[model samples]
Target: MKLNIAFFGSSLVSSYWNGAATYYRGIIRALAERGHTVTFYEPDAFDRQKHRDMEDPSWARVRVYQPTEEAALAQLKEAAKADIVVKASGVGVLDEWLEQAVLEYCGDSTTIFWDVDAPATLARVKENANDPFRELIPEYDMVLTYGGGNPVIDEYTKLGAQYCQPIYNALDPSTHHPVEPDSRFSSALLGFLGNRLPDREARVKEFFFKPAQQLHDKQFLLGGSGWEDVAQTIPNLDYAGHIYTRDHNAFNCSPLAVLNINRDSMAATGFSPPTRVFEAAGAAACLIMDYWQGVEQFLEPDTEVLVARNGDEVTAHLQNLSVERAKSIGQAARARVLAEHTYSHRAEQFEQIMKAERTSRAYV
Candidate 1:
C-alpha cells in the first residue's frame, strides 16, 4: 500500500548529537522511493535546529515543532491521522507520555513504537519493574527494533509485546557511497567515528584505546564528540571533532581501515550493527569490527569484514592489513551490503511486515 507515514523521531535534518539520524534518513528516503509519503516530525531541542546537516528533504516533509508538551501533543494528534503513526524511542521530550498517549490518539492508524536503540531501551525498562513503557508494549499495533535478532524479539515478547521484529541497519549507497578521499580525514592505518558514551567506554578502552596504544607507531584517527582528551593522551591517535554527515564518506574512504565498535549493551546483545558499519561498508572501506553474535548474518567474517575478539586481535588485523588486502576486503564488504543489505532491501522487508499487519487487521 502507498501509505502515509507519520514519523516522530529525533532531529532528521541535524545529525549533531543524534546517532539515529543516518538510519532515519536512509529508511525514510527508501520508503518515499517506494511511493510512501512521510511527514517527519522532530522537536527543536539540543540546538539541533541550529546545526542542521541539510534543509528539509524533497522525499520527506520535515516538520519542526517546539519542545513543549502542548507542541508535541499537537503533532501527535496530526500524526494519529496518518495511515501509520510511529512513536520512536528517544524523542528527547515527554518520551514516556508519547509512548502511551500515541496509542490513545490512534483510531484506524497502525501505531508503531520504533526503537532506534533497542538494547538500551530494553535495558532501561528491564531495570525498572515499574517502567510505564513495559506495560504499554502490547498496546501498540506492533514493535520494531534497531536490530537485535531473536534475542531482542524474545525479550519484548516476554514483556507482553504482541509482535516484534528487527530492522537491521543497512547501507544507503546513494547517500553514503565512495567519495574522493579528503586530505582532512586521511588515516593510514585505522580510524573510528562514534561519539563516546559511558556504557561503551570500558569496551572502547579495551577494543579501541588499547589497540591504539599497542600500535603506537601506526597513525590512527578518531572522530566524534567527547573523546578529545582520550585521543590526545594516545600519541598515535588524532581526534577529528564532530565530523558532519557530509564528511562521512571521506572519513570512511580516507582511512586505510575503519573500525566499528558497538555500545556495550549492543555488543552484549549482538545482532546489532550500528549505522557506521554500513556507511563504512557503503564507501567500500575495509571494516574491522568487534565480534558480535550475528556478524555472519550481515557480512562474512574474515572475508567481508574482519571480526576481532580483543585489542590484540584488532592490532594484529591493522598490522597485517596491506593496501591490497584492505582494498580486497573493502570491495567484498561493499558488494555484500549492496546486494543483501541496502535501505531499498530494508524498505521492502518493512513493507512486507506492514502488509501482513494491515491484512491481519482487516480481518480483525
Candidate 2:
C-alpha cells in the first residue's frame, strides 16, 4: 500500500510557537517509514523558518512556500497531484482559501481534512450555521484529527464526512526519550511547556498559576512563547521561553513532575489529549494531567498517570508524591506508551484504515 502523501501543515522544521510540530513529525515520519513518500508543504510565515530547530528530515521532503494566497494555491495545486492530499487545519496562511481550493481538486486524489484542533473547529461550525468549512465537511474523502476520540468522530460523521478517524497523540520515542537531567531545567518541582493561547490561558491560570501560588516552597517552571510577562508575575515560577522539540526531553525529565492541561474546548470535548502528554511520558517523566473523560483509554489513573481535577488536587499530588513513586509512575507511563501509543503503532493504524478504504473503494 505504498502511496505518495502530500501533507499540507504548519512548520515541519520548527516547534517555535507551533504546538503541532511533534504531532506532525511523529505521524509523517512513521508514514514514511512504512514505504510512503511524503512531501511536507509548509508556509514560510510566523518566523518558524527563522527559528527552525532541526534540518529537513530525511523521511520527508520539505517544501517551504511564500505565505500568500497565490503561493499557497500554487502549492495546493502541487499537492493535488499526490495519491493522498491532506489539507490540515491551521496552516496559518490563507487557510480558508486552501480549504476550499483543495476540495475543488477532488476527483483524482483521496482528499482529507486533518483537523489538529477538532473541538475548536467543531464549536465554530456549530456556532455558525453558515460557516463555509461546515458545508465543506462531507466533501472530503476522509477526516482525521489530533485527538477527541469518539466525540470528534461522531461530530464529523454528523457533518456528513464519509470517513472519520481520531488519531490520538502518540510518542515518537527516538525524538523524545529519557535524557540526562540538565541543570538549566532542574530544581523545578513542577514543569509545563505549552504556548500561552487564549482558550488555554484561563485553564493555565487555574492549574499552573494557582498551584504555584499555593505551593510557594516548590519550584515551578513554565516554557513556551507569550508567557514572558506572566512569568515575571510568579516569584516561584521560572520562565523558560520557547522550549524547542530538541529540548523537550530535558524539559520533561528535569522536573520532579510534569503537568498536562487541556485547552478549554478540548477539556470540555473530553477525549482530546494533546502531544505534551505523550512527550512527557516518552521522556519517562511522571505525568499528571488535568482530569479529562478519556484518561483511562491511554493510561490508567493513579498508576500510569495522576489525574488532577483542580489546583488543590494538583498541589496534593505534588505534596504527597515521593521520588520513588515518581520513578515508578514514570516508568509505567513510558512502558504503556511504548507498547500501545508510539508513532509506529499510530502509523500502522493509519495504514490499515487507508487500506480498508482503498479496498472498499475498489469494490465500488
Best by lDDT: 2
Residue-level lDDT of model 2, residues 134-240, one tens digit each, is 88888889999988889899999999999999988999999999999889888999999889899999989989899999999889999989998899989999998
Tens digit of per-residue lDDT, candidate 1, span 1-364: 8999999999789999899999999999999999999999999998999989999999999999998889988988888779999999998977887888888887569999999999899999999999999999988889999799999999999988889999889988988998877898775578888888898788888888898898888888888999977887888888889999999999999988999898888999999999999999999999999998989999999889999999899999988889899999989999999999999999999999999998898798
Give candidate 1's whole-model lDDT: 0.91
Per-model TM-score on C-alpha atoms: 0.98, 0.98
Task: Please state every model's RMSD to the true fold in angstroms.
Answer: 1.0, 0.9
The 0-to-1 C-alpha lDDT of every candidate, in the order given, reads: 0.91, 0.92
Off by over 4 Å in 1: none
Report how far residue 26 has shifted in candidate 2, in Å.
0.3
Model 2 lDDT-worst window of ten: 98-107
